[model samples]
Target: MSPASSHTHRPPALAGLELLASAVVLVDADGTISYANAAAENLLESSLKALSRQKLAAQFLNPEELDNICAQARLHKFSDLRQDLTLERAGRDPLHVHSIVSVLDEPAGHVLIELREHLQHIKLDREERILDQSQVNKELIRNLAHEIKNPLGGIRGAAQLLEMELPPLHLGQLREYTQVIIKEADRLQTLVDRLLAPHRRPHIVGDVNIHEVCERVRSLILAEFPAGLTILRDYDASIPEFRGDKEQLIQTVLNIAHNAAQALSARIEAGEAQLTFKTRVARQVTLAKVRYGLALDLHIIDNGPGISPQIRDRIFYPLVSGREGGSGLGLTLAQTFVQQHMGVIECESRPGYTDFRILLPLP
Candidate 1:
């Protein structure tokens, strides 16, 4: 049957299944898919129209398991049934899922399957662990910054005094050495201040329009790299204003954009660099141990050489940088600001593409 006719014949109750965050698929006793919802399409990484034309057993890594589940559901009748299964997709790695099987009573021989990827649980666990680590990092940074800050002022003062005491005639080169010490101290002081800035600043809360923030950052970036870079925006106008510190949000996005531009230096020189800011609404997202019904998904994607694998895992840590002469605090600050707003930031990178995804809870 054609996809249109196939969809029209699907049980009316299955319409509500599309609203669920978990992947839901309906199949006949013969293993042919009768219906697949949006979430199922996303998990399977294929359109419902395409998936409907295939068999459930063909899409699973262990086809026997799926066959048995369907057979058992049809024979003994089932509801709220649970199973662990693996899914197979073309050109992609197999995915482990927590599957729940049930018999749709209206469709006599139809079986309903709900699939939730184990990867989502892993990501949630990882995010929680990172949030815990961030707290520890902040504490350590505060203590270390204070310790270093105290000595830096004393060292700079001593260098200035020493320079003054040296004779102008014979010890001029010695004064230059003292000058170096003072200059180095100042640089260290600046670093210490930045390390403590997040803690020192007050979070000024207000309704923030995300698009305005993106526009501000885009204008600044274009002004800085007018010739070689293109800043593209794909925004969802339906996203509503949320409570946040607007300035902090702007800084957070700007920092990430600046780093992307810097990473695109080679592409920039060749005049092929592209940076895209895409915004969408994400539903049923968990951030920092709390589940949000709705959240803003802001993506900063760049087409450039990706992050170095050596430092990719540590990129969010303060003072960790993949590039030479980098202070390595931009991403750290971005993460800090996001966490302050009860949001999460994640990244995925390959050789030719890098995406920084920020999720902020919406009221």
Candidate 2:
């Protein structure tokens, strides 16, 4: 038996296409899309059926250039010829990609277009840096919390002693200052405890239904903002339960949802606030430098004024908040909890939309 013949091969249509992390689309000889992989579906923000119904030119800014490249590949029967292209999808920002068009040697004249998003490289690098920074921030928070925690007790005790030492009638105005010190010390103590909570708490793992977590968060949000906020659930019932800390997941989702609700206070008062909890199954997602075959995609989408661009990049940083009264540890703790489960959390915000996407690996 020959060595090459001894090995087994899998078809691209069945396995190869789906396994790829990059967006891929198979176009027919007539320039109509025949197939789109999962990544392609995500990139275009559309489904396979929808993508297949349209021609390739519908997605490209320079359709003629894309057509010429594909035509040249077909004419010369060449493979591996790559070019930079911009894909313009309606209602979404244009995407820049390095496209590789390969002519398949088939009677159907199928051409495979592999799209490697330029932004993906930037995103991956940013995620790596974020992860690194998250670790640094965590260490810093622990140390700072400890340092502040020790002094907080002493400050509150000293204020309490001073209050007891003063006469109630004669020190009426003076007592108020001591009371303020005590109150502020207690508040700082609470903040320090919260900063240390994630690290101190043990992760208790069990089978977690992501929808359950979403429903719990939704219920909590609706209960708090019952009159004005509208919370919608767009869940995929097919996703199976994965091993995770249920309470932690609930808390993480609630923190993000609560923040969204707070950000939508204006819209809520105007009766225009909307929060959607969407759940889907993603394939071939890379999270925190590790790629997973399948992952749970949870999206917390809100229609509000959107997050300010100035602090958007640092939203996950400890003590960073866009809201005035925000503790800022909500998202930081959420990120930490999600990372403990080997997942990733990301945010994208603009004028009318803000999306927090959490990707958790499925076993």
Candidate 3:
């Protein structure tokens, strides 16, 4: 049957299923698909016309389990059931998905099936944790900075007074100690200021062209690694300009690109380092628990020894770094800037490739 014919038979109340991020389908007691939403088509890697009237169990390696479940639902044995299933696709590896089957009263003899990728569920949970951690980090940093700032000034002042009160002969010998105290106090003060910088600065919103931001970061990285690294752009020109802080966006991209370049130091020296800036439009994206109709999908990819597994989860936390002498504020600040724009940043890394993705809502 044609896609239009199949869609016409779908109940009007089921139309909203198309807006969901999870794959959803309606099937009869015989396990034949009656309707598949857009997400379902994408998940199954098939079109509505192709999926219509097809057995849902046929798409999986363990077909009997799904068939049994559908039969039980049809017999009114259970109102809903959730199970983990493996879907086998031709020419692709098997996918692990969580399936929820709920009996439909309106559509008698039919059940609604929702499919969610296991990895996607993990990603969503991680994103939620990051958002919660970010809020806590903000509060902790603010209070810590305030606590340190007050004593920092007093320490510097006391060091100056101690230096002035020294005897003429002792002044020369003791001057170095006072200067050390004063200099160390100043350094600590600077550190405190940086900790609070993101909260202090205004957002400075304006029309932001994501491609322009990517180009700026690309140039900066190239300038720093002029000899070996190659920066590539795979941008979607159709992306519309949105309102945001241009400088903050630039810094966010730059911080992530710069970190990638730093990680690629060995590859750069070998004249094989390659970093790519990719941008596209993503629909039905959820950021910080709020769903957006459309969002910017930006990726900074590098061919380098990927992030260390030990610190991978804590890379966004303040004062955490994989590199020696690294302050670890780069990614923390990058995440902060992205969060300011109602977006989220995520990283996936392996032995040879690391990808940092930033998703921001579109106007």
Candidate 4:
């Protein structure tokens, strides 16, 4: 038979697999791959044409186990089977995935396989938890700020009144004590205002160029750290302008980058610090349980001592900080502003590497 005549055509029913986020593959009774979806192609790091040319069992390190599973499904022993397997790649790290095998009714010997990366599942779970926790943190902060604000004002007012009512003879000595009380109250009031700032400010909307925001932040950071740190830009110019608050977006990026720079102080002094601002367009992204066709994938990466494990999970919560003397409100406010634009921020950190990723929907 001619090469053209021997080429296998994919069944129309399999086209819908492309819409799914999970990787999917279809194999014949002989264990030959007949179809691979977009997600599958990406996971396998090969095109459908190439993947189809190879046996499905060859993709995994343990081929006999996969063949046996396919055989069981083909024999009608079980309608479905689930297992965790590791996929071997040519030049990349092995991918651990949870695979589900289902026997197709129409195709006598065909089996459908679905794959979900274990890390992706963990990431999705973490994102959901962060979203839920963020809501609770905001409520707690707002209520706590208001409660503290009322008592703070009263304390400051009473201190001032007592300072004024002090006798002229003892005023000099007594005034110092009242002044300390007044100053501490003022400081607490400032903290409360910052805590409530995100909730009080109106979101100003406009067409924002993410690169411009990055540039502004870059200039600011460089101005502060001139000698030791290196800030690299890896921006995709094809990203279109999106509707968002330019100032808020700037603040979001600034707060993240600034924290990274501060964390790099030790490395900065040694002249080996590095920070990277990366931007890309993410397709078929799901943020806060809502899927979007396109989204902004922004990363603020730094090489520094990683965030402490004790507070890593609570970094976005108000008053949580990894650094000594850190007010801990920077990341909290950053999360709040991003949420206002229907976006999400996620962090992954380990010794020598920390990545803060921000995902925002695009039009």
Candidate that scores best on TM-score? 2
- Candidate 4: residue pairs that collide: none
Please give the lDDT score at residue 233 for candidate 2: 87
Candidate 4 regions off by >4 Å? Answer: 1-15, 25-83, 87-95, 100-113, 119-122
Q: Model 1 clash pairs?
A: none
- For model 4, residues 36-86, the per-residue Cα lDDT tens digits are 877787677666778777798898987788888888988888989998888
Q: What is the clash count for each candidate, in the order shown?
A: 0, 0, 0, 0
When summed lDDT is taken over every stretch of 10 residues in candidate 2, the lowest stretch is 2-11
Residue 34 lDDT (model 4): 78
Better structure of 2 and 3 per lDDT = 3
**Candidate 2 deviant stretches above 4 angstroms:** 1-14, 46-54, 77-80, 89-91, 168-171
lDDT order, best first, reads 3, 4, 1, 2
Residue-by-residue lDDT tens digits, candidate 2, 211-253: 9888888888888999888888899999999999999999999
- Candidate numbers sorted by TM-score from highest down: 2, 1, 4, 3
TM-score, prediction 2: 0.90
Q: How accurate locally is residue 183 in candidate 1, as Cα lDDT from 0 to 100?
A: 93
TM-score of each: 0.82, 0.90, 0.76, 0.79
lDDT of 1 by residue, 64-154 (tens): 9888888888886656578899888653357899888887676788898899998897898889888998999999999999999998999
Across 223-310, the per-residue lDDT of candidate 3 in tens digits comes to 8999889998898899999999999999999989998999999999999999999898776778889988778989898999999999
